[model samples]
Target: MSRTIPFHFVDVFAVAPLTGNSLAVVDGGGELALELMQNIAREFNQSETTFVLPATRPDADWKLRSFTPKGVEVFGAGGHNTLGAWWWLAAAGRLELGDGPTRFHQQIGDLVYPLAIWQSQGKLEKIIMRQEAPVAGRQLSNLGALATALGLNAEEIAADVVPCQVVSTGAAHLLVPIRDRQAVDRISPDAKQLFDLLNEVGGEGCYVFSLDPLQPGTTAYARFFNPTVGISEDPATGTAAGPLAAHLVAHGLAQPGVIKVEQGTTLGRTSIIEVGVDAGSVSVSGRGIVVASGAFSI
Candidate 1:
């Protein structure tokens, strides 16, 4: 028998209540089937919907399963899916917090990560996610071809600042650099072309960046386009931001330290993503706000 399933909506990596990327979180997934969760995700149609379940392994505190509206399973080594749920639980007083920062573990697939929750006065202030160690993948040799695919002039592709390369902290993304903010603002990509190009290069999507940021404190301005998994543009992408930080450090564009990034302004929903790099590991953290919640019965 179909039952009413309760889900929460959160603005992940948000600066304000309504901004940042949106997500739907379903708790108590141990009794729910994978197919049911996928159908729920399709019904929600958010960027992602995450299901929280009791941890099957002794090492992990909880289990998370994330899906796109298209029912595509998103890799969850580190991203907003896990963060949003954890944030909701901690903020709602569902998770136990002993009056200070608490450490826990979460598992997605074969990877288990250390999760830190900071709660002040029974409200979640922020979540610090330690992503997988950075993996510097292939640098695109065919910048001209990539430019054509992204609808950018070959000259506008900031080859001098840093070459567009494939990088992954967990999920793979092609990081492209534009010379200036004006160049970044003018991008109009053929979705099909960009999607096909990324698929061929082993990336889930591409993150176009500009060193010329809108604000002085932010290190870069960026936009994410992913058609392979049905996302045309993401407001904020923690998955891509981690890799972008590592890519910048590898190319000497930014020092090996905490770098702030601005995204989603062009789309009206502005978001700030923080990236921390030391040695080879990258940490991404941000704030999430609970926007809405409801129950859906099928």
Candidate 2:
């Protein structure tokens, strides 16, 4: 005899059902073994898959564990995977939400984080998640090697505007400033070389961005790559966007308010990530829609 587990495919940070970053949300995954979870993640083959589990600690309302297609366990409460899972839970009526803003605690790894959602007339509005305090580390100085890794000329890097450095809200990713949107679009990275560079810089992924955004009122046009975790390119990465917003503010490149980041244009799944940085703390918020839901047999 076999059993099936319910799952949902959500488009996080999306304007429509199919846009933004796709995530697989698995319900009642706490009973499954670790190896089985990895196999399920590989089977889905998305950038990330999230498992919603019952909370072991009293302080948390629920527990979330996200894994990459490569079986790498992602440990960030502010990631799209976590947000999409919560969205699915709320939309599926798995959790009871109030009419206004309701708060919930999510246990990711060893720490618990707070998340809020707004509801009006029994409809879910938006989800906001607070990330860890911003931390800066490991500035890269070798522009020529970095350029080679990204398949661009050394002169294309806008080092005068902001230094290429690692920033983290929860997951540390290297933030590189580019000359323009065209240059950002033209990047053809060598994955192996880029992964090596990221390893050297103590970074998990690379976020290349330009000040000139294609969309008005957007702070930056960006692209994300995390070869270490087998994500060739992500449509929208909240973990990276939060850090980029803080990095810009720390370097005096942008104001410390609501920073909108436009990404995934090159992939055709355009996404907008709203990040707010105030007094060295960061928060990321977005909305997601359920495009597909089914069951996984075991």
Candidate 3:
């Protein structure tokens, strides 16, 4: 007989509900098959969905797996999904108030995440993780063909910075720095052209960014497109935000510390993502609110 498993859906990186990236979480995923997990992730239709499995090591906290809607297993860490999973575990009473730090053994490697829970004015709040510093990769291409793929004119591209470069902390993305926020908002890339350019750049996807240093801590504005990976436009992307922060510091565009990223504005869903970079590794963290909780039979 099939048994229904409990799950929780959350909006990450938002202080309130409905403002950040959404993720679905299955709390106990020790026995689910990889194919079944992929199918469930596809049915959820989110940019990323997570399954919490049993940890082999007695000292380890949990074993987590992340999957995209396209059924591809993700390497490295995900910001919103991590936060969403923590929120679910804490709310369900599986984790205590002073659980200290939690270790997640992911596809990339083992990640240690510290938990912080506070009660202020009778409202409960939690911040589960800090991301590692970003790792910079080689510059790949210029703005010529990339501009064509992104539906932008050559003149509209940024000359000071090159386009179609690879950047990563744990996951790699082709970084495409645009000229302005307006150009970023108007982007509608041709799928075939985008796929070809991504292959040429040796990246799985592309991240489009523009400087929006007007905000006190915010250094840039960005939107990620990965039609090749089954996501047209990501509302808030934590994986991309890590490398974007590194790019800003490496290029001297922003200070080498904590920075804020604003995304999904053009898509009508605004999200604020925070990134902390120390030395070389980067850590991306944010708030997540539980939107719904239920169960499904496999």
Candidate 4:
């Protein structure tokens, strides 16, 4: 007999549903094989999906596995997945508001998600998560060859943002800072070339940002593309945001504190991601809403 498993679809980093990046959560996925998890994620066709399993250790909180629609397992973490999993657990009554720091054992290592709920207008709000410290990688050369790989004019890139580098909080990405927002909005990457270059250099994807550091409230306008991983465009990318914030601070582009990043404008799904970096450690946080929940038998 086949048993049905309940799942949730959550929009992460958006105040309203369908505005932020969506993730599908399978609450008890320990019994499923890696191939099965990848198949389910591809069937859902989201940018990313998560599988949650019970923790083996008594002091552990939860074990999670993340997958892209193309069946590739992701290491480290994604901002939306962390929030989506917690929201599903809390809403299902498996986790309580006072559960302290919920631990997540991922392929990367141990990740702690501290839950916090607040009452506003007599309604309960879900907890927001702060990501762990980011790990920085080697700074690659920002030569003309790299620009060609991205289908961008070498002259269009900002001269001041030297050493077009690869950075990672948990996931590695190419940090490409453009001269202006026009380049960011207009340029389209040669997905195949970009992916090949990233893999050759041991990076996951590329993040392009137009610097507008002088803006009062906004820090930068950015876009992320990962065709190699089957994400044409991300509505809101929390994993990239953390390193972007660090890049901004390291390059003297913005003040070292909290800054707001706007993404998905060209895609018609506007989303805001907030990040904080201090002393080389980065933390990304955002609000998410549960759009739909249901069960499926496999």
Per TM-score, the best of the predicted structures is 2
| Model 1, global lDDT | 0.86
lDDT of 2 by residue, 79-147 (tens): 799999999999999888999989999999878999998899999999999999999999999999999
- RMSD, every candidate, angstroms: 1.4, 0.8, 2.8, 3.1
Q: Which ten residues in a row are the worst by lDDT in model 2?
A: 70-79
Tell me the deviation in Å of residue 47 in model 2.
Answer: 0.2
Error of 2 at 296 (Å): 2.1
Better of 1 and 3 by lDDT: 1
TM-score of 3: 0.88
Residue 177's lDDT in candidate 3: 80
lDDT by residue (72-132, candidate 4, tens digit) is 8765554777666766766666754443443333333355444344434433454444555
In angstroms, how far off is 124's CA in candidate 2?
Answer: 1.2
What tens digits encode model 3's per-residue C-alpha lDDT throughout 1-298? 9888888888887746887788899877778888989999998999989998776555557667888998987656656666677667666766645444434433223554443544344344655355555656656555778788899987676746644468877677888787888898888999888888777766767888888533355778888888777888888888788888888777777776678898877776778888877677577767778889899987
lDDT string, candidate 1, 12-69, tens digits:
8888888888989997667887798889899889889999888888999888889998
Between 1 and 2, whose TM-score is larger?
2
TM-score ranking, best first: 2, 1, 3, 4
| Local error of candidate 4 at residue 90 (angstroms) | 2.9
Q: Which candidate is the best by lDDT?
A: 2
The TM-scores, one per candidate, come to 0.96, 0.99, 0.88, 0.87
lDDT of each: 0.86, 0.94, 0.74, 0.73
Model 1 Cα RMSD, Å? 1.4
RMSD of 4: 3.1
